[model samples]
Target: MHRPTPRPLAIAIVAGLLQLPAQAALYAVDPGPYPPAPASGFPAWYQDSHGRTLDLCLTKAVSSRVAGAPGAPAYMCTLLPTPGVFDDTQPIVFPTNFPDEAFWFTADAAIVDAARGINLSFGTAIEAAFAAEEPKAGDQVSFARVRIRVDVPVAGTYTVTHPYGVEVFDVPAGGRRAINMTRDIGIAGAGDFSGALKGDVGPFLRSVNGPYTEGNERFIGDPNLDEPVTGSPFNTNFVRIEGPNGIDLRTTVFSVSGKLSEVNRPTPLIPQRSTYSRHTENGNLRAQQDVFVMAPPAPATVTLSSQTPALALGEANGTGSWYAQSVLNPALPLTLQVTADNSLAIATSTPTTTPMPLTDLVVISRAEYSLGSGQLTLVASSSDETSPPALTARTGNGTLIGNLSGNGAVKALTTGLSPIPPATVQVSSSNGGSDSEPVVLVP
Candidate 1:
């Protein structure tokens, strides 16, 4: 189990207030297929079993470059202060940037090798494009997964703390135990796609034929009117992970998918003619998962706040589509306060008076210049991949050099510097993070 350095009085007070029970600690581990190439040296990183890179605190957009089978031009986005993933010091919020509907998974567990004893693996994937099917087709969907392998292991308790809540399992030591958890949110009947909001699936948003309003008033219409729901602790919207275990072939898996988007497809009854219909009719298209590792000493004290002006606690943009939760205990719900465009502050803790600046999230990971070609290659990453940071360069004397550009997280500046390189190269992002490194002449 891994633990971070403790805070003074605040932590002591929190422990006394929460009065949590005594339990063994667990930390997250990267079970990797590993990256074929480097992310240019970033922390909390790995190339997952599925060939997708899992770099903590950063957003990764997985989509298709061709007709289907999503791959290529992979996005290595910016880093953000994601509390639970790398640091569980804050509550996990959904639809991070209004309409983005970006849900994530983080873990607090250790990485163990199978040959030594336990074999573990983890990763995530999203659908390539929208398609219909009898057997196979693309529909908007995404998921996170973990695979554990061990033999004739110890007999003890296995606990998984995820975004949803904490679940406990008792193992007898020699038998096979398989854990499966699933959740699906979206339209009436779109069939088998794992996507919730309209923006995720298509250009259209959810709407009804006539005027209607529910007394709840949180949303204009029943957002989850006719959607399949599963999982404990939450009926909808959550992600986290936890583990510390023995052998006995223990395998855990979970998936989240939704078909909220209405698209053109052949009516189920009539196969030939194409008709506009919801995807729920297809059924069981995708899945989801996230992680959380519990360690000794003390838990990270976190505060829940809205990134934007939201309507209410557990609701965003006039709909009950977003929420926040307690990573430690599922029974104890986290609180939120909405004061006219203000953030969602936890009732138990003091709210943050200032928002986190972009400089804190965006960063220049590495930069270098080639003496032969006079080309400078810069690599950067951000937690907010949705809003990629634009990059620029400057010289020691404060003169503008030239802009850098490249696909994904890498940027390149080929023009402007010739005979002599700038004494000092200062690279910066629109998001505020910058790095100044000496332009070492390299052959």
Candidate 2:
């Protein structure tokens, strides 16, 4: 059964005070600055382990209030608001020689090709569809590492608002203050994206808004922005830096993806092969995301039900803002209704009444046909193969040649045609994943 969205609790707030979420702890050491050093470049870029690229560069800040203010040198970056498109908060600009690496948002520390490393240095704009991998057997977990250091023109208390939560720090005049928030989201422990209010600022994750509709459901190019753990109007990702006087710079919300896991790592206590799937099924009261325990040999016939404050899985994964899966998919506001034989742990997210397509949720690696045997094979894979996408094949003329409800990864169907038809083969998924390759004659 679907769990209902939690209603906002009644609370009072004292104006002009920084509010941290209830029970949220401070990061011991923040993830430091991006670029990490000096560099020469205009528009720069960094690609994560999964090949997801974040482009950063210098652009002139624009603000009507700062008339004749020589628009401070600000940052123009890509990743948030959507991948490929450049957006900036036009924060007060940096000094002319401000090291490119020391800019506002730098891309750093990522898991690539199953190995961990950092992709430093900005590059030219590279356009690519946004994609993220679910944490399963053999795949390394990924996450966003962030730290904020603000050079105060005139120091006071600066309130920092981001996708996860809010942070207020004090900096002396002309002193640089670094908010060590590197531990916001991690495999172990909780992030600061959700929870109760300590002051006026708490969960800063966006809810519902014009153009930013669907809250945090998968946006067209960004499938990882679906924050179903919190449910309706899924919140997108962003960071707002506000300081004394009238200093306010807010980034355009963007989308990214990551997951939690326990392989060689001792913490987070996740099963080795745990994974998840996000979908919008009929009758769902809110956004729907479900988890699974990929227990080797075959996919189990396990069921999931939404539960308030989650269940044992939540306790097992530790606590805080980090969800069971990607902040995009999330793992709060829901849990698994496990069977007695179910030893694997799982969690859930808020349900979505609306459905959206998640890119690469099902990826088709190869589709080919053997002319000699007239045998056609479609090889595809999803994060969760237990509930794989429906596979369909057709001719160029739209002739339905083969179809199968995907069971595992490879689906094969022999045309059995005595004389193989001279046409193309196309494969598609019920979840909007697809591939088309010309009919290549192969022995």
Model 2 spans with C-alpha error above 4 angstroms: 1-144, 175-181, 184-236, 253-443
Candidate No. with top lDDT: 2
Q: lDDT for model 1, please.
A: 0.29
lDDT of 2 by residue, 314-364 (tens): 212212222233323433222234321112211221111112223334454
| Root-mean-square deviation of candidate 2 | 23.4
lDDT of 1 by residue, 243-338 (tens): 344333322222221121111111101011101111122453221111111101011121233323332223323211223332221111212222
TM-score of each: 0.22, 0.23
Least well predicted 10-residue stretch by lDDT in candidate 1: 267-276
Q: Provide backbone clash counts, one per model.
A: 54, 27
RMSD for each of the candidates: 26.6, 23.4
